[model samples]
Target: MTANANRLEVAGHSVLLTFGPGLETVAEEIDALWYHLRAADDDGATPQIRLDYALPSGDLPAGAVPLPARPEASYTISGHLTREVIRRLIGTRLLLHAGAVAHPELGILVLVGASGAGKSTASSMLGRGGAYLTDELTIITPGTFALTPYPKPVSKHDPELGAKRDLALGGLGLRPAHEAAAPAPAMVLLLERIRDEDEPEEGSSVTRVPLSEALTRIVPQTSSLWALPGGLATLAELLNSVGGALEVRYREAAELEELLRRLPPAEHAETAEIEPRPGDVVTWEDTAPAPGRIAAVPFRQALAMESGLFLLGEHGAIHLPGLAGLVWDLLADAGPLTFDQLEQLVVEEIGEHPESTALVRGTVSDLVAHGWARRG
Candidate 1:
C-alpha cells in the first residue's frame, strides 16, 4: 500500500482506498470520516475492493476507479463504498437498512426502517447510554443471528451546504464501535415516526406488530433479501428468536430510551418451519386476467401466522390476509383455479356478498400482479 492509500476493515472485508495526486484535501476528509474503520496493520487480508480516486483530468492508474470532482465527492464515495461492501455480503448476512445499539443486558436491539425513518437519530440517541453498533446498516448472520459491527460515521444533514456531512462518533459524543463491548443479537424494533398532523394527542407508544405484518414491513427495508439463501424462511426464524417485532411510533428520538428500557427482554421461542417451494415465472403488468383464466401460486416459501400468511416469491414476500390467505391455501393444494371459480369459493366461504365478485376478482388480480400467482 502506498502512503496515499488507506485500508478499511468494513463488514469483514478489507477495502484499500488509494488517491491520486492533487486530491489530498478530499483524501484527508475521507480518512477522518472513516477513521473508525482504519486498519491497525495490514494483515495481508486480500483486498475485496480497491477504490482509486482521482480528478477526471488527472493521470489514471491501470484499473483505478475515479471519484466525481465535486464538493460532495466524499459523500458520494461513502455511499459507493457501502454499496460495494454490501454487494459482497449479499448471501452471507441478513442485511437490514437499520441501525443497532446495545441494551447492556439485553444485547443488541436493531432499529429497522427505511431511510428518513429516523434510524440514525434513534441510534445516535439510544447509543449515548450504551454501545453504538451502527447508524446506517445492520448486518446479521442468518440462523445464528450474530452481528458484524460496521459503525460507519453518522451522516448529519448540513444546512449550510445543503448536503450531509459524515461526522465522527467522537465528535458527536457517542461511543465508537472500537470502544464498545462485543454485540449479541437480541431484538428488532420497527420505527414509525408519527407526524404531528397525525394526531399527536394519541402520544407515542410501542406496540407489537403482527408477525405477518412485520414481515411485510421488514421485507422492503432489506438490501437484496432475495439473494440470501433461506430468504423469508431465514428471516422468519430470526424474528421468532427475537420474540417477533415491536413497532415504536414516536414524535422524538429522546422518548425511546426510557420507554424501550421498560420493556422486558423477549423470551425466544421455537419458530415454525417455513416450507420452500419451486417458483414459476410470472410477468407483472397492467393487463387484467380473464374471468376464465386459471390462477396458480408458485411460491418460494410460505410462513403462516395466527391472522395471516406470508408467501415468499422470487421478487419479494406478499402478505396474504383473510380471504387472500384462504385463497392461497386453496390454490396451493387445489392446484390451478379459474378466476370465476375462485370468486365462487370466496362466496361460499363468506356465505355470499354483493361485492364478493369484485373482491375476489381484485384479490386474484393482485396476486398475479405481484407475481405471487401465475395466470394459466
Candidate 2:
C-alpha cells in the first residue's frame, strides 16, 4: 500500500513489505526473504499480506545489531509474514516441517524430527545423491504426497560451518527437484539424533514402522494438519500406500548416506479419489436435541479412546479429551439421542450435578452447530 514497498508471490499468495525510510539498512535481509519469489510482480491489489518494518534513529538493524540479533530480527519479522501466508494456503495442500531429498529413483525421502534434531545437517550430507527437496518446509499435495519443492535457503549448523549460516542450494552441492519431473514421496523417515551415551550400541539402524506409529510421529511435523480440508483422511491413505514408513535412529549425519542409498524404491500407489464434500454445510442449531438419534457425518468419523477421540472428517482430525471426548463418544456410539437421553448419559458417567443437564445439552448444541454431529 505504501510507495516504498517490495512485493512477491508465494504459493499463489501475494505478500507486500512496506519499509520505513531508515529501515533500508537491513535491505539484505529483506531482499533475502524474497529469494525465490523476487521476480514476481508487485500489482497493488495482488497482495494478501502487508507488513511494515521501521528503524529508529538509534541504530540500524544491520551488522550494528548483536551477533544473533540481525538474524533474529529479520528472520522473525519476515519469516512470520511468509509462514502466515503459507498457512492460509493449506486448503488444497499440506506443509510438513521436514528436510526432503530425492533418491535418483527411490522417489522423495522426507526426514522429519523435532527442532535441533539435525534435519538440515542430514540433508546437506545426503545432497550428493540427488535433488535437494528442502531443508526446512516440505510442501506437497494430499493423497499422492508428491513433493512440490519449496526450496528456500538451507539453514546450516555445524562446528566447521560457523554459527548458523544460511547457505544457498549450490553451497551444499544440491539442487531443487524440477517441477516437471518432481517425484512422489516414496518413504518418510522419522529422524532422531542420539547423544554419545544414547547411541545404539550396535550402531545406526533403520527399521520398518507400522502405519499408526508413522502417522503419530508425523503429526507433530505438520503445522496446519487441522486446516487442510480432508487432511487427516488424505494422510492415512497416503501412508498406507507407501507400505508404511521407516524409523531411523542415528548417531551421525553422514552415516545415513549409505543407508539411504540401499533403501528400495517405493511402489507408487494410485492416489485414492475421494469425492469432495461440502465442508461448511450445517443442518442443526443450538436448540435442544430432537427425538431422532444423532450420527457422525458420513464424511466425518472419529476414533475414541480413554484419553481422547481422533476424528477424521472434512474439518480435520480433532483430539477431544475429558468432557469433549465423553460427549463425542456418546453421540458417536449411541447414534443420536434426545436432550433427556444425552443428559442422562453425561450424569451417569461423570456423576450428577445441578447444571449437568444444562451442560450436556449445551455441549450437544455446540457440536451440532459446529457440523460435528447431527440428528439422524
Query: Which regions in candidate 2 have their CA more than 4 angstroms from the true location?
Result: 1-9, 30-36, 40-45, 56-69, 157-165, 177-181, 200-202, 264-331, 335-376
Candidate 1 TM-score over all chains jointly: 0.85
* Highest-scoring model, lDDT: 1
**Every candidate's lDDT:** 0.75, 0.63
TM-score of each: 0.85, 0.65
Please name the candidate that would achieve the greatest TM-score relative to the true structure.
1
Stretches of candidate 1 exceeding 4 Å from the true structure: 1-3, 43-45, 58-62, 69-71, 179-183, 197-200, 264-291, 340-359, 374-376
In candidate 2, list every pair of residues with a backbone clash: 293-336, 294-335, 294-336
* Per-residue lDDT of model 1, residues 1-376, tens digit only: 1338888888777889888876788788888888878877988877888787776654666666776556677777878788987988887888888899886665688999876788888889888867788887888887678788878888767788798767778877777666423444677999988888867577788777767778889988888776677767788787877777888888899998766766644534333545644453333342343455655555556667666677765567787778888777777656677767777776777787888878777877777687666675
| lDDT for model 1 | 0.75
